[model samples]
Target chain A: MNSSASTKERILTAAEALFAQRGFEGASLRQLTAAAGVNLAAVNYHFGSKDHLVEQVFKRRLDQLNARRLGALKHIAGLQETTLEDVLSAFIRPALDLSHDGGGGLFMRVLARAFAEHDDSLRKFLSENYGHVMRQFTVEFARLLPGLSKEELYWRIDLVTGALTHAMSGFGIIQRKSDVSETSHREQTAEHLIRFAAAGLRAP
Target chain B: MNSSASTKERILTAAEALFAQRGFEGASLRQLTAAAGVNLAAVNYHFGSKDHLVEQVFKRRLDQLNARRLGALKHIAGLQETTLEDVLSAFIRPALDLSHDGGGGLFMRVLARAFAEHDDSLRKFLSENYGHVMRQFTVEFARLLPGLSKEELYWRIDLVTGALTHAMSGFGIIQRKSDVSETSHREQTAEHLIRFAAAGLRAP
Candidate 1:
């Protein structure tokens, strides 16, 4: 990578950790710059402003996460034999994989903070950029659960999203045991989430 | 009410709003006291320090919320006739009701922040102070399901909690129509959560 590109990558990496640890508001520019080993000019040169940097932090992970989710959904979206669990796995496995990947779990913590932040600009940015990914998943979910009204489907999906977000944020009690391999632990986590989400989505 | 008592209430109310609007770390003491229309000394006199103030903020709401949860759980915990839905209702309705109650929803937002914050001291405080409520509910949930192993049961409960916390934090897309009464909306929310959670916990 070029020097400029590596500089940008360093800032993004440090920003992700600081933001996850100290929140968007709490993480100061000075601290972020110091952590990244970059100067103020470097940040300004790259991302223009802290707000824009935050957006990039989200875009970096979410773009990949949602793309994988959409890629998975395409295979079974409207298939007659696709079970609810299949649709759920497509939606969930990517997130679980992301969380287990190096530093991806920290990104999930940042995402959770964004949800809690309730910042209007961030919300709008997410909705505008990634809303279609969710809409596509909703369509697949609708195909499998023909009994639910649109409102009901939205409610269930929102709840499932909440559960997944919470779990991915790593705040819950279910920790991976030291004895378990990373891949094994990820698979176990996926199974638990998929089963629970599938049943929740199918609830009468 | 007495002057000191009302002062404390004012601080808590303001703290909840500021914490929700910004965050635990983002909301400064100056802002908190200013919003409360009080001085630094008053906060010090009333709560000693910001950390204690945060604890009091949680204690004020959690005490009432968990009391109601336990009260509801007591009515139908282990009875053979109690359906999974009943146990789920006992656990969920109180939270939904709390979220609709005055300023309680803001507290949920704060709770979400705490989860995201992942502060060790705060986590310990919550576990030590209110852990019993969750334990009681878990016992009842185990009795009702009887099929899930302890580890599996804990995993599912954690997911259900994540979903409920996410929904109650008011970040999800689900919104009440203007025509709907607050009570009606809350009832609808409770129904959706209990049904989803019941099915989730009962998943094979």
Candidate 2:
């Protein structure tokens, strides 16, 4: 049982790295097994197939991430007026903090790649597995911004979610070119994203 | 020369489709050449390498799109106190219009896939090639929103760009499941995005 657990962990670790380095089609089972120092049979034994492996990698991080987002939203739900800042923090803080967690950075990159890649199977998996989490956030957001129409609320939430995902992915389109410290850049990004999102959320 | 022109076009069409479907690393030159209905030597003669082929596919559409954006921005610049609508139109209309143009839709899908893929070489190529276009938008945005600091502008633009890209890619997370027509959805998205972005841009 102990050996089996270690083997499963190894498969997951290698799968995440491969998925991040090369997308779904680019990362083959042979490469995955080799990287994990396991046999092909072991991959099938642990994860069934590449698709399952990809799904597992995402589920590992996203399940926790969504829980945090929902938890934060629940904490703020008691307020009579959900300030833009409160809405922004509940969504952004969990994501940003996740980036700093163990292997969370790599997972962020993988998630970014998944969205950007737009593979049909991956998209289906994401929609199926995490659609409820997203809907939960949407429900909270709707309550927070009660004045906006249902359609408007959905659109704002869509844009806000897209922005948050893009920022977390490390695209760094806004990163300064000079020899600035990485810590400073992270702080700047966090502050800027929150402020920018707040403006978007509160816009007339 | 006539043969060469047709060959180039064929290669691009094939590359765009394959790249969109299979991503950069996943799509092989062998498959590309075969799909293009050209011999291997023809591809080598025309584009030199897979990377060059990828670059050419992007450049074809991006050059035109950027030119249009610049033209719109220039027109807006000539007017004093550009309205939120003007700024939003200048930023988004070109992209939406491009989607309607011939072969432009494929390029959009490919561009989205490029971001989602894990090829560093391709990512670097895109950033180096089109980074200036984004910077140009940023400069104009900063001018329009004098209330926002440069950092704030970048952050907002970053989110705006992400949402726009997500929409362009047709992920459709905001779609209502109950008998909603696509045309209405498109109109709703465009309108909602503009309002959301304008609010964000105008946010202090």
Best by DockQ: 1
Please write out the lDDT profile of model 2 over residues A47-155, one tens digit for every residue: 7877788889898888888889888888887777777677678878788777867767677778878876667888888888778877877776676677888767767
lDDT of 1 by residue, B1-204 (tens): 598899999999999889888888778989999999988688888999889999999998999889998988877754658887887888888888777687777888888888888778999988877799999888888887888899999999999999999998898998899999988998999899988998888887
Tens digits of lDDT, candidate 1, A5-98: 9899989989999999888887888999899898978888899998999999999899889889888888775576888899889998988888
Report every candidate's CA lDDT.
0.88, 0.78
Pairs with steric clashes in candidate 2: A116-B116, A117-B116
Candidate 2: count the clashes. Answer: 2
What ranges in model 2 sit over 4 Å off? Answer: A29-41, A78-81, A174-191, B28-35, B39-41, B174-189
List A-chain TM-scores for all predictions. Answer: 0.95, 0.86
Best by lDDT: 1
Model 1 DockQ, alpha carbons vs. true complex: 0.84
